[model samples]
Target: MEAAIAVLVAQFKAFAGADGSTDTLSKGEFQNLVTSQLPNLVKNSADPAVIEQLMSSLDQNDDGELTFLEFWQLVGRLANQHGGFSR
Candidate 1:
C-alpha cells in the first residue's frame, strides 16, 4: 500500500512539470499522465475531446490545472471501483 502511494505521488510529480508548474498538471500534462500511466483505466484517453471533458470534470476549482488533490479524485474513484480502497 505504501509503495502504491509512492508510485502515485511520483507519477504526479513526473508529469506536473511538463508545462511549467511543479505543483500542478496542465491540460497536456494530465492528458499525458492518463494516457501513458492509466491506459486501461481511461478509455479513449488519446482523444482531445475526451481529455477536455475529463479536465472539466476534475478541475473542481476551475483553475485549468489539476493539483494533487484533484488528481487523487480519479485515483480514488478507480480504486473504489476495483475494491482497492474499501478494505
Candidate 2:
C-alpha cells in the first residue's frame, strides 16, 4: 500500500514538473500523463475532445489546471472501478 501511494505521488510529480509546475497539471500535462501512463485504464485517450471533457470534469476549482487533489479524484475513481469497490 505504501509503495502504491508512493508510486502515485511520484508519477504525478513526474508529469506535473514537466512544464516546471509541480503544483498542478496543465491540460497537456494531464493528457500526456493519461495517454502514456494510463492507456489501458482511460478510455478514448486518443481523442482530444474526450480528454478535454475528462479534464474539465476533474478540474474542481475551474482553474484550468488539476491540483494533486483533483488528479487524485481520477485515481480514486479508477481504483474503485477496477477493484469493484462498492460505495
* Model 1 TM-score, 2 decimals: 0.89
Query: Worst 10-residue stretch by lDDT in candidate 1?
Result: 78-87
1-87 per-residue lDDT for model 2 (tens digits): 999999999999999999998989999999999999999999999799989999999999899999999999999989998898945
TM-score of each: 0.89, 0.94
Candidate 2, TM-score vs. the true structure? Answer: 0.94
* Runs off by more than 4 Å, candidate 2: none
Instruction: Please report how far candidate 2 places residue 10 from its true position, in Å.
Output: 0.6
Per-residue accuracy of model 1 over 1-87 as CA lDDT, tens digit each: 999999999889989977667799999899999999988888899999999999999899999999999999989887796776666
User: Which one is best on TM-score?
Assistant: 2
